[model samples]
Target: DIKPIEQLNINNLINKRNFRGIFGTQPPLSILEEIDYIIVSPGVPFDIPIILKAIEENIEVISEIELSYRLSNGKIIAITGTNGKTTTTSMVGEIFKESRKDSYAVGNIGLPMISKIDYSTNETSFIVEVSSFQLEGIKEFHPHISAVLNITPDHLNRHKTMENYIDQKSRVFLNQTPNDITILNKDNPITFSFKDKTPGKVILFSRLSTLEKGVFIEDNQIIIRNEEKERLLVCPVSDIKILGGHNLENALAAVAISYYAGIPIQSIRKALKKFKGVAHRIERVDIISGVEFINDSKGTNPESSIKAIEAMEKPIILIAGGMDKGSDLSEFVLSFKNKVRYLILLGETANIIENLARGQGINNIKKVASMEEAVLFSFNIANKGDVVLLSPGCASWDMYSSYEERGNIFKSLVKDLRR
Candidate 1:
C-alpha cells in the first residue's frame, strides 16, 4: 500500500501540504485545492461541494468506468437502464460462460469495473450493469457493444430531471463507432428514439412487436435479423425459466448481446433455460396455508413495482413503502386497481402511498410500523389463493443499509411465520 496521507505532519501540511494517498472516506475539502484530478465514484453526487469546486476550477473529473476503459485490453458489453440491467447482465455472463468465454459481470451488479481492469486480456469479455450515476461522469468510456434496455422515471432525485437522466444514459454509446454495436428497446419510446443518434449499428429488441432489424418474438420463438435476413433462432420464449413478460424482454436483450458476441444459438438457449432470474427480483420466498409470499425488494421505484404488480396473476396483498426517492406514485397506485386486493404499507412513504391508493379508490390500505408487522398483518388478511408480495416502491435506506437487507429481513419474517 502507498504511504498514508495521515502520516503527513499536520504542522508540515500547514506549511506545505500536498496530496499523499487515498482518503478512506471523503478527504477534507481543503484537499480539493491541492488535487488536479478527481475521479468521482458513482455514489458521489455531481452537485456536491467538492465536485462543484472541481468543475469551477477545471479539474478533470471522470468515472471509474473511464479509468477501467483506459486500462482494459478486453471487449465490453455495457448494459444500462432504469431496470432489467442486473438480470440482463447476469444472463449475458452465463451465456458467455456456457460458450466457453472468459467473462466478468461487474459494475452495479456488485463489483466495481476499476477493481477488475487488471484481470482483462484481449479475450476477456466484461458484462457491465451500468447506472446513470456511473454514466454521468464518463468521458471516453465506450463499449464494444452497448444496450439501453429501457429508461423510465428513475433516480430523478439524483439526476434531477428526466432529460438529464436520458442524456447521461446516452453516454454509454456516445464514443462508439460504426464498428461497434448499440442495442435499444424498440418498444421504449425514449430508447427507440436513440437509433438516429447512435453512431454505430443500431439493433433493436422488442417483446411487443416484430422488429425488422434486431431481435423479436415470432410464434413464441426468439429470432434475430440483420439487413432483412433472419440470422438465428435463439430460444422459445416459453423455455425461459424466469417468470413474467418483463423477464421476456430481459431475455430478448440478453440474447441479442450474447449472440452478437459470437455465442452459439445452442449455448444462448442453454443459458436461458437454466437462468432462474436474480434474487430479490420477483423471487418467491415461501408459501404457507396455500398463500404465496414473493420478495421483490429490488423494486425501489414506481415503475419497477408497477411491473411486479402487473406480473401477478393471483390476487395479491402488496407490502410496499420505504425511503422516498421523489418518484411519482400516481401510476404505481393506479396499477393496483385490478389485481391488488389489499395494500399493506410501511416505512417513510407508507402514508404517501396509502394516500395515493385512497385517491385511486383503493380502500383496503393498511399502514404498519415495521416489516414484521406488515408481513404478519398481510398473512392475517391473505386468503388461500392470495399472494403476499414485498415489492417496496422506495429505497430501503431509511430503515436498512440496502435492499438486500430489507429482502432478507422479509424472508426471515416470512419463514418465522411458518414455524
Candidate 2:
C-alpha cells in the first residue's frame, strides 16, 4: 500500500481512461501470475510485500531511469548525491546550452526522465539528477559521465542504513566502462571512497584541496589536470556567484561534467560567470528594513541546512523545522551556535528542533504555527545586518505539497510583510 495512500490523484484517468487502482498489504498472488516484469517508481519501497513476492517468483524489476537508458538515444550525464544535485545538473545544462548542444536536465531535478525521451536524439545530452530512491531500481542504466557530488546522512527513513544509501548512489556507475568518465568529490570522504568502485576513468572535483589529475581550486582559480600532466585554468573562484563551499563543489562538478562532454572551456566559463544558482537554494528573496530575506526551502536535510547556515555572513534569524526524515538532528542544532541570533520554527519537527537547540545552549527560539507567522516573527526580531533565512532542516511534506510550494509561500509572505 502507498504509505500516505492519500496521494492517489488518479480520478481523471480512472473516470475517462478506465484505469484501475489495486493495492494492499498483500495483493493477490494471482495479480503477479500474468505480469511479465515490474517497473517500480522510486517512492515504492522494495521491502513491500508485493515487491518481495514478485522477487520470490523470479519476476524482473527495473526503474524508470533504467527504462529511459534503454530507450533513449542520447548520452547521459547522471548526477547523484545527498545535496548539490539540482544546482550541478542545472549548471551542466546551461553549459551545454551555451555550447549550442541539445540538452535536457531531467530526473530528480523535477522533470521525469521518461517524459523527455521523445525529445532526445543521438546528439542530445541528458543531464539527470538522480537520487538514492531512483538508483535503487536501476540495473543497467549508465551515464557517459556519472558525477557523485557528495554523500551524507540523508533519506535514512527509507534506506535505514548509511551503507545501503551509499550502495544505491553507487549504482549510477554500475554499467560504465573505461571510455566513460566518473567525477567524484575529493573532499567528502564518502564520495571520494567511490573512486575504487568505479569501472571508468575517475576524475575528481574539490573545493578544499588541489588534485593531481582532476578539477580543483588552486590560487583562487579553478583548474583541471589531465593524465598527460597538462593543466588548464578554467576560471577564477570569484567568477562563481553561487554561495557557500558546497556550491563551490557543485560548480567544480559541473565544470568536469561539461568539459568532458565536449563543451569548450570558454563556453563553460561564460556560463559559470552568469549562472546565479537555482531557485529556493539560498536564493535571495528581498531586503526589508535592512534585513535580507533568503529562501532555501530546498534544504530538506540537516546537512544541506548546515551549508546554508555556514554561508551566512550576518547573524541569522533562522526559520527551520518541517517533516521529519528520521535524521539525527543534533548536528543541525549544533550548527546554530555563534551564527544564529533567533530560531523561529514551525511544522512537524519544530518541537524536536527546539529540544535539540536547547541542549546546544541556543536559547533564543520561537515556535510559530504557519509560514506567515514564522516570517512575521522573524521580521519582528530581525535587525539591520541580520538575515531572515528559511532553511528548514526537514522535508516540506508536513505542511506543504513540495519544497517549491513551501519556498513560494515563504517568498510571498516576506514580500507582503509590513515594514
Candidate 3:
C-alpha cells in the first residue's frame, strides 16, 4: 500500500490481507514495522527520535541529494556555503564551456541533478550547487573538487544549532579520498578550522592573505598557485562585474576550482571578465529620478545583507525583512546607522526588524505591508545620488515563492514605476 506522510494523500491504502496504512499523522505502530527505507526532504529536520527508531528497526534513511549523488556518473564539482554557491557554480560551469568542455550545471541552484541524469555522458562534468541539507545524507557521494565557500550562522531554525549545521555541511568530504580536491575559504574561521578534519587535498582560497597553493588577491591582481607552479597577473578584482568583498572571495574560490579542473588560465580569465554576476545578487535594475535601484533579494540572511549594505557607497533607502530565519539583526544595526539613510521593513519579520532598528537609535525605520508598498516608500524616501536597495535579510517564503521571485517582483514594480 502507498501512504502519504504529513499532509500528503495516499492513493493506495490497503490491499487484501497485506494491510497497508496511509497516515496523516505519524506512521502507526503497525505501518512502522513494515517500512524498509525512508527518504527525507531538506524541509524535514533530522530528528533524533526518527533516526533512533529507524536504527532500532534496521531501516535506512537517506536524503534526495544522496540518492542523486549515488546515481550520478559524471565528474561532479560540488559547491556549498551559506551564500555565493549559485554564483560560483554558474561561473565554474561558464569556465568549462569557455574551455570547450561538455558540462552541465545542476543541484540546489535550480535543476535537480537527478533530472539531468539522461543528459549525462562520458564527457559531461556536473557543476553542482549543494546545500547543508543536501549534504546531510551522503553515503558514497564524492566530488572531483568540492568547495565549502564559507559557513555563517544560517538555517538555525532547521539545523537547530550551529554545530549541527556545520556537521551536515562537512559531509561533502566524508567519502573523499586524498586524490579528491577540497576547496575551502581560508579567511572563514569555521571552514579554516576544518583543515585537520578533511581527508582530501585541501586547497585554500582567500582575499585576506597570500596563499602558496590557492587563489589570493594581492596588489589588485588575483594570483593562483598550485604545488607545481604559479599563475600570476590573472585579473583585477575591480574588473569583476560582481560587487563587494564577498563576491571577490567567491570569484577566487571559482577560479581555484576551474584552474584545478584543467581549464586553461586564458579561458578562466576570459570567463571571469565576461561573466556578469548572477541575478538577484546585487543586480542593478534601473536609475529612477537620479536614484539607483539595486536588487539583492538573494540576501536572505543578516551576513549577506550586511555585505550588501557595506558595498553601497551612497546613502541607501534599504528595503529589508521577510520571514525570520533566526539570524541576529545586531550586525545590520551599525550598518544602518552608517550607510542607510532610510529603512523599509516588509513581510513577517518587519516588526521585529523595526524594533531592532529602533532600539539601535535608528529613527528612519518604516514598516510596510507589501513589496509594492516598500518599493513606493523607498522611491519617495530616496534622493538624488542615493541608492534604493532591496536586500531583505530574511527568507521570502512569507510573501513570495523564493528570493528569485522576490527579486523579479521588485524589478517589475520598478519598471512599472518608471513607465
**How well is each residue in 1-419 modelled by candidate 2, as lDDT tens digits?**
44333566655765787544664345566889878888888778899877888899889888888889899988999999999999999999999889999989999999998998998899889999999988988888979899999999998989999889899899999999999999999899998999999998899888888888889989999998978878999999999998998998899999999988889999999999999999999999999889999999999999999999999999999999999889999999989989999999998999999998988888999999999899888888889989999999999988998999999999999879853
Error of 3 at 113 (Å): 0.3
lDDT of 1 by residue, 341-405 (tens): 99998888888998888888889988889998999999999999999999998999889878998
The model with the greater TM-score, 2 or 3, is 2
Q: Best candidate, TM-score-wise?
A: 2
With candidate 1 superimposed using the best TM-score fit, by how many Å does residue 391's alpha carbon deviate from the native? 0.7
Clashes of 3: 0
Q: What lDDT does each candidate get?
A: 0.88, 0.91, 0.85
**Local accuracy of candidate 3 as per-residue lDDT tens digits, 64-183:** 767776776678888999989999999998989999998888888888888887777767899999998878766778788889999999999888889999998888888888998999
Which wins on TM-score, candidate 1 or candidate 2? 2
After best superposition, candidate 2 residue 65: deviation in angstroms?
0.9
TM-score of 1: 0.92
lDDT of 3: 0.85
Candidate 3 residues lying further than 4 Å off, grouped into runs, are 1-36, 48-56
Sort order, lDDT high to low: 2, 1, 3
